[model samples]
Target: MWIPPPVRAPIGGAPASDRRRVCARIDRLVSGGQRQGWPWPLPPSGPLGVGRSRVRPGALSVGMRRRRPGEPLEPGNAHQTVPPLPRRAPRPSFYWSDFNNVAREVREFCEENGLVDERRLPSATELRFMPHPRPWLANGIRRHGGWKRVAERLGVRTATDVLSQPADASAPKLRRRGGPQKPRHYWREWKNLRSELTKFVCENSDSARYMPTVDELEAHNRYDLRYAIGLHGGFRLVARQLGLVARSSLIMRWTDLTAVAAEVRRVAERARLPPDVMPNERQLRQYGPRGLVDGIKQHGGLSVMAPRLGLRSQRHYPLRRKPRLFWTRDEADRQLKAFIQQCGRVPRVSDFLDAKRNDLLTALYRLGGLRSALERVCAEMDIAAVQRQDGVKT
Candidate 1:
């Protein structure tokens, strides 16, 4: 009906048989050959169909044996090739065998550029390279310019190489700063003057008199005349100016002068006379001796006797009547001493009288009258006489 089927032409003009052969070869390469009896061609047993087969009896077929748990089945010998593993690129080799020569080149460069002192070149053993010595050298050179400049920059006047150098025979010897100088003679003189002044001030101060109060003499008997004399230097100088050495000496003797002056002042005050007027012996005798013996006996000998007599008052008083009068202080003193000696001591009022008697008599006699007068006189006179006479003796 329609035009005969379009005429067919072969592309690449290959025959079907050739294509089949090519496909067969590819199948053999990929899958191996088809199995004959055991899903693989068993090797031929010996000598055509003989009595005993050559194949071993217990041997396992490829399909019957369990491929060891995870193992892959063995491939046919023709197809058993492994692909190679990927590999890393190799590193380039560093040409370090020329290191010594490179070091030599560096040394030559340093010498040419004045980067180091040629004569002070470090030995090869000493010139060790750090991991990157060139960068360190470049940085050091940038910072300090060169080795000698670096040493100067670091305040090193003498190079380390110079320290290692032999000592110079022609160098000048160093002279050390000398020791402290001795003090001058005037220093000693000044010290001596200071010491003398200190001593003068200490000895001449008013405190040195040891007279802290006017009553000081009553407590301390030893007056320091040397200290008092030193204090009188101002007066002595005035006296000396007036050419009165004798008078100055008299005044300077504080003990003698003070005593005489005290006595004269007392007498003048009592007489109501001017200090220029002196007292005669009679007046002094009459006024002075009247109360003195009693005072001494009462105050010095029997100060404790007052309380024993039941007298509460500390006031001094005269005997109301004449006592058994001793002729002298010496006589009174002797009698007191003898009384003290005789009684094996003087008997106290408390010793002579019991407490009842002391209270009764003290109250009765203290009321005034003859008993009061008699008790007063007894207090003034020696206890021995009062005991013997028992009343006033004419």
Candidate 2:
């Protein structure tokens, strides 16, 4: 009952020797298959050889050990699972211009259509984006002859549609040409005439009060006569008259007048006087004209009242009436001597007073009666010195 090799057996329906050989072959095939990394378990009907028989229709025993519940399975010698590849997006169509073809087509179209008449034909600039059917396709018919023709065609239809249908009818009309040139010379003449008229008006008017002298008038004209008059006269008729001008030319020269007016304003502002020396409304009402002392008292408050009262202006307070005394030259001299003896030295005078030596001396004499007093003191001192010398031992 020894079996032959699997190679000697037929595929199927073979003899016992063949069967034995098949069985031996199957064994050898299985062994070989295992070595070659194929699934095990040959079909019973097949010859015992590699790849000869199909296995059971059930889950094929791929020589892969079954994974236990919750157990990790070993990798088989099969192709790995791969993720599906991503799809690419389609590209957009682009249109490129062929200038040569376009130009040739345009020339041909112009020749064919008798559009060579410059006046009737469109300008080169207007022909931009002109379409040619031949370039697009030989038989492709272009609705527009060129850009101008297309525009014209569309414009007519668009205009018709607009006219037929109601819309916001207030859209502004299209201007066909550039606007008018600015009037430069007219403006220049107008300004010059205005200035000359302003001068004439200022000088010839008799109603002008405080007519500035020639120098004054020139100065005012240079700056602004109207403004000066306005500032000085405070809206006088003269100022108003100068400012008003009926002529366009005069009106144009108003800039010069304006400049003058500005200068006058500046001068007036600079010349403005300081606040009044009189008391404020509140103070005047509260104290009245005779309330100078009271007003001073109020301003000084109680803290400063004593010093203010002691001031020279307030000296009449203690004295019933201002004192007056008459003194002869000898009496004045004696008094001055007595005053010098009491005070020790004459008072120092100001530098300005010292510079006017005679005036300072006169002032000192008049104010203090020092001149006569000094004379009397000198006489007495001279007698005393002589007496003292006599008393001293020779």
Candidate 3:
């Protein structure tokens, strides 16, 4: 509040308030606010109010009074300088000079490391150690033409130079890292697998003990034979190699037709029919001609016997038409809708197939495509009941 008595002129001469207003206006004008027409609250009426004042144009109107005589300037006083503005980084350009420099550095690196004239190019691991601002040899080679052209331009030998030579050339071979690789099939393991299969066949050839159905094979704890068959070609070749039965026979064991013929003749003689004559197809389908049908049934079916006896299968017998075993279309759709309601979601085609209902597959396709049919079924299905049953929101 201690303004010099000269600055505090009472309401007429320049007061301290008028001096502050003038100084602020000058600062704004100097800082380029004049073009914006930013006006000062106090007009440029000089702090003197009427006469020409000592305040310089566009300068802060401070200390207009003359300094008293014989006062020395302070020692710590120094001129202030504005700090230099920071410079920006230069952007890169794809100029020939830059490309040439990149090429030269890469060529030198290749030559020094003995990679320039070799058949083998540097591995990714080796390339990682390339010097800074490396031009990344791989990227450079790809971008500036290719390896051959870049190398030719640089007067360096291309990687292809060594490769183009015959295999018998004097260039040393690239040794594999980590020593020799093991063979794919372990010889001892294969041998053991073959021995085990051979022993199994010899022991169980007469009995069907070792003959596994596809499902059984999948479920079995032993994977030896399966692995061997898969590793080698397949079942037939492996079985043939091991001197077992033919692959077809392995799938469905062949019947001894001569033994079957003897059994039929005995059954016929016991039934008091001519020893050579077999029962009619009708008789075979019925309670199976008493003893004969029951006996054949015991030994698989009359179908198996008919084949052995050099007769057509009784299965193909043109008897009275039986009722259709398959579900009708409406029945199938009903079942599907019922199932979807029960499960709370449409079932997959695989679900139908796995259900082993070939009829259902037929009916679904007949109604429409599987997805469309399921959509239709789902639309009709009682979703609310399904949700309630499943204890989840639909």
Best of the candidates, TM-score: 3
- The candidate maximizing lDDT is 3
Q: Which pairs clash in the backbone of model 2?
A: 6-25, 26-48, 194-249, 194-250, 223-260, 224-260, 333-372, 333-373, 337-373
Alpha-carbon shift of residue 14 in model 2 (angstroms) = 99
Query: What value of lDDT does candidate 1 attain over all alpha carbons?
Result: 0.35
Off by over 4 Å in 2: 1-286, 289-322, 326-331, 343-364, 367-373, 381-394
Candidate 1 residue lDDT tens string, 1-394: 0123322323134576643443344334324333323232222233112222212221121111212222322444434333333232342343323334334534653454343453443222122322112322333233333444443444433224443421232222222222111122322443443343335435543543222221232133313322333354533452343343323222223334334435434644686655444444444445443333233233322233333333222235532332344234344344434443545633344433642234323332334532333344446654433343343222
> Candidate 2 residues 29-102, lDDT tens each?
65776687643333233432233232221112222121223232224523433323333234234311333343
User: How high is the lDDT of residue 313 in model 1?
Assistant: 25
List ranges where model 1 is wrong by over 4 Å.
1-194, 197-254, 261-394
Candidate 1 displacement at residue 301 in angstroms: 14
The residue-by-residue lDDT of candidate 3 on 1-394, one tens digit each, is 1113333223235666766675565445435544655232223434334343533331324312322223222223233222233332343666333677556657565565656555344332344533322335556555665555565666655433433432322334333332121233432466866766666555545543343333334444345456656677766666566565443422242245454456565555555665445655454444232344445554656545665676553244443332465556677778777666655565665565666655666666766656665655656763322222221112
How far out, in Å, is residue 46 in model 1? 99
